[model samples]
Target chain A: MTDTTQAAPASTRDRLLDTAAELFYRDGIGVGVEVLCRAAGVSKRSMYQLFGSKDEVVAASLERRLPASEAFLLPPADDDRPPRARILHVFERLEVMTAEADFRGCPFVAAAVEVKSPEHPASLVARRAKNALTAFFQGEAERGGARDAALLARQLTVVFDGCGARAVVQAQPLDGLAVVTAAALLDGAGMRS
Target chain B: MTDTTQAAPASTRDRLLDTAAELFYRDGIGVGVEVLCRAAGVSKRSMYQLFGSKDEVVAASLERRLPASEAFLLPPADDDRPPRARILHVFERLEVMTAEADFRGCPFVAAAVEVKSPEHPASLVARRAKNALTAFFQGEAERGGARDAALLARQLTVVFDGCGARAVVQAQPLDGLAVVTAAALLDGAGMRS
Candidate 1:
């Protein structure tokens, strides 16, 4: 027999995370704890025993996803491209993600919209991620010599949000990328040669 | 008491619509039918008898809010300003909306994210409304002699979507409007005087 049977506890945690991600992504965070437990094939007791509450599960899922996104959004220290090129690279990465068959918009933005209460742990985590993005954009814009770095950073963030929503809503990934690139160029981030 | 009793049916429908909108906007469309019925003070049989399904209630609620948005998006002819001015006017109106106390992103965009299937009737209606906005944008861009009207229209739509999401998520309406205006300028649409 294969060794798959031996790792039940880890597998259960993975399953719970995967199920929570799907439900939170597709149905929003308001989905009940019992529903998540049933979908994950774990008992409600196991879920609470492992993660305490739905909010903790959400936080764990976000913590798992955020690092991957940060890796994609932040330009590498050794990267030699100009600030403008780095900005375009971020949008290019977005395009590739949205092109996937199961793309469902930015998970962070979705969480933010669903959690109305700012005091919620999930909301606080999401806000931290969002603020980090804004700061990253602002730093990049400053390096790019934008006269109004704050304004430009804010505009770029808007483009990021807009592109994600447009890709999902229009069901066209390339169209959203085209808009992102056009917006970047318009904002004076000249296209790479 | 004599006339009040006769106005019950219309009032009930209005109450249901209002309650559904609140729940749908806050909790999402996946909220159970029973929860909606209980929240609205209507019996399950009455909910089904009147609206057919939860989907129909969502559709009707969206339709109820559509006219206000449509009117803002497609304002009556104003010979006083050029087409570009009129186009930018739409964003200004949206800015006012975001500034409202109860502003919670664009309901259509939020609903679209919740409803996974693109072919759902409510999704279709939201899509049609979005398409109409794009077409309206294209007409204005064409009138301004843009080289690529379709592209500009798509770009503008993304800006609107992004700004609305940011406004709701950040609870900063002015920030959203600022991004919108910046996007308009970047798209080569001259600032309204």
Candidate 2:
């Protein structure tokens, strides 16, 4: 429980964002601003003051989540695990993520589909989430000494995103399957399997 | 354009299904029934009489599409191509599918995400679509003489779906990469690559 007195504007804003993120990720973006205000205990006036619009709230929520998602997909900093293993470790985190009761698929993929306009704020946030994963994969692939880091990164990201979709659509844990497939992918690419 | 005056009930019904499927697939299910009715040039009364609800319309659209989707993924009957090749042929079709300007990844995948409720009518439709793909893969795997046809089918499906998600998120083709990974998956499983 946060101290109400110490709760600043940032705290109020975070409460709103946290609620919005949960609703948006758990359910689709079909959720509305009125419902969002009700869920967050914030008035509509303050909601708009803080976040501008529902789209901004959506984008902000995704932006807030980007680092956490990146971290979960990232193995660790200063850890000497081989690059291929680090790359595969993303699935390990994925398994843990999908194991949660509230597990939903990739929020970015959902947002990308829901916010149809390519230049929409939420769309850009979703794109950032996706590109972050790709860049992470590229860093690890380069560390693992892949001859073509970009190609490897793109392929791994596909398997990663695919696993997310399968997990949600099938409503089951597919990270193990993804991990196995990723290994085969590494081996096929002449990386350490 | 459909001829409204001469349209029989069956033709009117098909017009709704055809237009709804086109709209639902091209855009997300965000397109409402009013828009669907408008596009199909049908009355809401007739639409309700034929399909029941928007959910039903979405489900029916997907159901109406099953045979055609199956046809594209299915290897040619009496296809003289190697079983492994038949198995990999799905990606070949996938490339063509994604190449369409209006392609929005897998409709079933989109439906699975967009429909929200797993027990929803459209949800079930999406599941059926996925299962059909799996069944197709299993058949090809068996025909290819795989030691474990089901295993190859599952693995290949992962890569197949991964490619689909990747293609949409990146707005680029990863079917080529998926084809390569599918080959490796087959090879690793002791199936012919």
Candidate 3:
């Protein structure tokens, strides 16, 4: 549907990245460059020209997903929800995501895990993505006067990632488990309203 | 080294399973059969004879690891520690494990996520492994007289898993974060030693 004639390079880049994200998420990071290019409908020559290596594609795909991923999990910018609710909002979204049949796990975490090399480019991107969530939590914790904002943020991130793993391994709905766990942590930290 | 002279079939099976567990854990599930057989000193035909397929190898490798994995993570059989201590012991071991250079999160979790299929033989093995951990937690929770033993056990499993994820993504030592978070949840649930 894209007007390939206008800004063709950018359009091609977008197409490749979109495909990469989906393929990698569904099929682990082991997906080869040949398969990736064929699936994206982009020629191997063009893909190589746009990205230096398949690793670059992996990193870029995850990087491109960061904004939308945060948007989906985090509350709206203008919404003045309480810090507790804002924090809980992430888990509520995650619970719904886990209910979907195709939900594998957090793509970022998956990339990091599959790569097995923490120093890999995709792992770095995944780390930043996870850190961004932790930072968001820390900011809210500070605003809400949590006893240890940094620790609370880290704890919340752990719960979020843990819930994702549980959903994948169990292949079962979390029901209200994620929300309840997050709320318990919020309460334990005395983060009321 | 396995003595191939005695009970060669069983020895071959042991060698293949051990190598498969290490290779699959270090590398992702995408390691080709050729590479796996080469590393294990196994012939492709021999591997097929021992296990019906690569999927079976993955499942059996994980199955072979269950006892050692549980022993590594859980308290000793004769451990007379109270319920709370028994539960926390798992996190302690996890923190230690995460500090290793080659730690790639929980093998079961990594397998389940990498496969992206809940019904895959390996994924089933992963689910059973994770459930065993949860069952261990549940038993301890009940013994501790927690208000909601099932929920507490679930929460504890989440914390344990999340801690693994945090360590993997950040590539940093937990430094007691897992223990603290687990303890906080225990306190919140009124699970006293």
Candidate 4:
């Protein structure tokens, strides 16, 4: 309570959300309000003013990462690659992400699993994020003329998540496992280039 | 420290680990030492005496669950099913487990993700547990005559984990996604019955 709140509301909000996302990903979701505020360099009062509670902050922060997550994981808007390549591109990116020393699997999955309560706001955001990935996969599957786009999409998503989990549990990069698994799914679905 | 260490040491350890598994699975690994001890009805002093640290408790609890985890997830002993059936049986079990209201994904995967530090004792135990699953898959793949047993085993593991992640994020049962994906992979690998 003693700390002064000098930063403007907008900047303060951005800073808090950024810090929240980073800390929550690095550590577990159990990080306390004091620790989060301290890491963000924001006062407790300012955090409360912007976010109703830490749970809201967790949800909002995950929401904020969605656009960037899709942008990077999904193919570029102007890219001319076929549906199959476009879909495989996502897994390729995942393989690269997993190679990083700090990689800890999909943040969305991590958050939802750690939150435990599926009804929690953060878990809701996580579900939405996961669904978006599935939607992307389904769209690609359809464009590629797969026999059953919906099933193919779900299959691809399962592979995506499974690869992420493997990386985390094995504490090793996927190398090309992501790409190979996705390719197998695409092949099985008869999703042509 | 005030609470007396009343129970015998062996029973006390069992009670503590059992409670730890239940609470940690229901909640997350972040459950504090005091809360865990209180739930187990063991004094803090007694818990410390038995387990060197909370981390050890987490690891040992997970280690204790391994036998049952394998027994349930793996095909039953003395079953005469073929390799494909044995492999699909695991996913069938996973589908059933995910249907439970209390399902929270694989405890080992959850623990590894929550711990963040791969070197953590709990993470190591989780890795060992996951590896056992992969080994079982590998054995079945070899028996079934997979084109490449190692790769097929890895793919199956990825699908298993991906389905688990899907269940946790969606907060809904997989509804056969697990079995279908594993079957697809088995087909792609050309693993004969």
TM of each candidate vs. truth: 0.85, 0.89, 0.97, 0.96
User: Best TM-score goes to which candidate?
Assistant: 3
TM-score, second chain, candidate 1: 0.79
Off by over 4 Å in 1: A1-15, A38-42, A50-52, A176-186, A189-193, B1-15, B38-41, B179-193
Candidate 2 residue pairs that clash: none
- State the lDDT of candidate 1 residue by residue for B120-146, as single tens digits: 667766777788888988887777776
In the range B1-193, model 4's lDDT, one tens digit per residue, is: 3235544677889999999999999999999999999999999999999989999999999999999989998988898899999999999999999999999999999999999999999999999998889999999999999999999999999999999999999999999999988998899899858
Candidate 3 chain A: minimum summed lDDT over ten consecutive residues — where? Answer: A1-10
Model 2 bad stretches (over 4 Å): A1-7, B1-7
Model 3, A1-193: lDDT tens digits are 4565668899899999999999999988899889999999999999999989889999999999999999999999997998999999999999998999889999999999999998899999999999999999999999999989999999999999999999999999799999999988988899988
Better of 1 and 4 by lDDT: 4
The sequence of per-residue lDDT tens digits that candidate 3 reaches over residues B141-193 is 99999889899999999998999999999999899999999999999999979
Candidate 2 on A1-193: residue-level lDDT in tens? 4666667778889999999999988777878888988999988998989876888999999899988888777877976888888887897888777777666678887777766555679878877788888898888777777767787777777777777777767877774777877777777667882
What is each candidate's fraction of native interface contacts (fnat)?
0.48, 0.50, 0.90, 0.91
Scanning candidate 1 chain B in windows of ten residues, the lowest lDDT window is B184-193
Clashing pairs in 3: none
What Cα-based lDDT does every candidate model obtain?
0.73, 0.79, 0.93, 0.93
- Which structure is stronger by lDDT: 1 or 2? 2
Name the TM-score of candidate 4.
Answer: 0.96
TM-score of chain A for each candidate?
0.79, 0.92, 0.96, 0.95
